[model samples]
Target: MTTNMTTKTLYLLCSAAPPVFDVAHVVEDAQARGWDVCLGLTPTAAHWLSGSLDGLAALTGHAVRWQYKLPGEPDVWPPADALLFAPATFNSVNAWALGLTDRFVVGVAAEAIGKGTPVVAMPCTNSAIAAHPQFDQSLAVLRTAGVELLYGESGFTPGPAGLDTPPHFPWQLALDAVDRHPTAQA
Candidate 1:
């Protein structure tokens, strides 16, 4: 199905991770579900998708934003009804929970929560990183603030540390969770 600009807007804030390269799949899937998707990447994720920026822009019909725009820069993207933080790194999660908004993705995610936007996050950290005390605390903080975190049983779990395979990044689950959020329907 072709999603037009009039559909509900979703700001997909992608962080750097192995799954960052597969963001096109999420965009297409979201579009198929009738969302007008806008992508906001962390600096690193933007670099990772640098070669495909034009393609991404064409697909979303909007520029993929990473850095903060100048004060007078005309905003081209539609207002977002929801924000999905996919491939969220451990750093981004922790930073966001602590109210750090230095990076565009983290900053936007933080602001979205404060604005009561329907927000969903899919963290892509390994068990080792997830085991950090701060990681658990961050998850707790976000969950307390009504952020839908796609982690543990409801989301992706880390694979064996030494395995050659990366844990499957559940891009679709993030969208599903967002759709299920009360704010989205409100």
Candidate 2:
């Protein structure tokens, strides 16, 4: 049932944000930190990285899963000890909070809450979307449901809407948060 029993499994779920472009580095970092990393992407993210999908799968030594498996089909990746949802877009965050499973990554994240899987999410969005009242409400819902959300000053700080250079995403912060989670410690 486990991929590498000695190594903790981390389901690195990513949405289609600019940060997603640098995910290969993040995977390497996670591997160096002793995690058995399994990369999962949102549909659009999968499309964005279509050309490099093979390389990513080879990097993680696991299938890059973006779509749900058919009924009666076996799961591809190992069960997660913890999950890190990084560069989560506004839509992904809200969808996850509301239990919308249309996207594979969001579905897994939403289900992880009830499965008692430790989850750390760092949402990537512009200041314009961050200002939405619904986004705040969605954040509250996720927090109340025991999801470790990294937003505002704690993690990803959204810059102005049209900044030529968006604020650098703090991948290390999210990784550190995952390390601090109970499941990861176990």
Candidate 3:
């Protein structure tokens, strides 16, 4: 499949959130919007989508990555023109803010801050998780680092705990954020 040279690359990262099950549709939406979408997942998220990995790769025309490349190994995905990490879980959000490099999705978002890559994140969490003080702190840290956070009323609002599914992940908001980002316009 041929890609337009002018198409911007979007690193669409997902964490172990319930909405992650719908990631394939999200990728297709991004593609329709003219993005060269590369999918990345947290370890658990990757495991959740294990059966669909190959189909996802075929759909995106790129490898679906959930781990860091080995030393001296060439990067499989192209450099991200912008990143949209939706359905980001509370743990992933905090880990990324704290500069924890343990999880591949969070690690890349963390490093992206320092690299000045435009990033937008929509965290999926319950009211219980959002109540944690550290969760707010992490959101602040990410905002300070220039990561556009889609949370609260503008993004994913936490519902009561123990739901089988989260409020619909605000993927469109993340995509809109990316479209509005200065780097994306350039």
Candidate 4:
């Protein structure tokens, strides 16, 4: 169990979906295992969360990115080791899979994927959207692009599941996936 894994840099992209609490739990767990976590919240998501960016920064010790604003001048772009999009809204998922980078999360994901960085997307949207033909196609595209889509315990949970805080299992599972991958080693 004494592997020399380099410190992981995790970029968490949050959407307005209700499952964001689950995403928070994942971030906290990732931090516990020495991963540096940075959060990028969609404007809609920030409005829905009802918390200040400062609060998030204090909690994670990293600045919260609310827009696609680059880190320059007053900001510094953090080098990401990996990217995770938990509770990804159907809209965001489709946009990301289809190469639409109008949003910060999608933009970052595109960049990371281009750089061969590991990407895991945990999409949480309505069942209808998840079942839509377009959604299926989008997932196929992401898979072909080397993005690991975790369809949750099943094939993606839909609708608001009341954010029953994800038990530590998901975080452990994510880390384990990273460890098992040869490229994840420093």
Count clashes in each candidate, considering only residues at least 3 apart in sequence or on different chains.
0, 0, 0, 0
**TM-scores for every predicted model:** 0.92, 0.95, 0.96, 0.80
Which pairs clash in model 1?
none
**Structure candidate 2, residue pairs in collision:** none
| Candidate 3 per-residue C-alpha lDDT over 1-186 given as tens digits, one digit per residue, 9 for 90 to 100 | 216754688999999888999888888887777789899999999999999999999988999999998999998988899999988898999999888888888888888888899999998999997999999999999999998888988888899989979757777778888989877764
Per-residue alpha-carbon lDDT of candidate 4 for residues 1-186, written as tens digits (9 for 90 to 100): 111353667788877765665555666677766667788877788776656566667666676776766556554446877777766777888998888888888888888889998887777665555667988888888889988877756335454334433222244555555445555544
The lDDT-based order of candidates, best leading, equals: 2, 3, 1, 4
Tens-digit lDDT string for candidate 2 (99-184) = 88988999999888889999999999999988999999999999999989898889989998887446699999998999887668
Q: Using TM-score as the measure, what is the rank order of every candidate, best first?
A: 3, 2, 1, 4
Q: How many backbone clashes does candidate 2 have?
A: 0
TM-score of 2: 0.95
Quick one: best lDDT, which candidate? 2
Q: How close is candidate 1 to the true structure, as a TM-score?
A: 0.92
Task: Rate residue 5 of model 3 by lDDT.
Answer: 58
- What count of clashes does model 1 give? 0
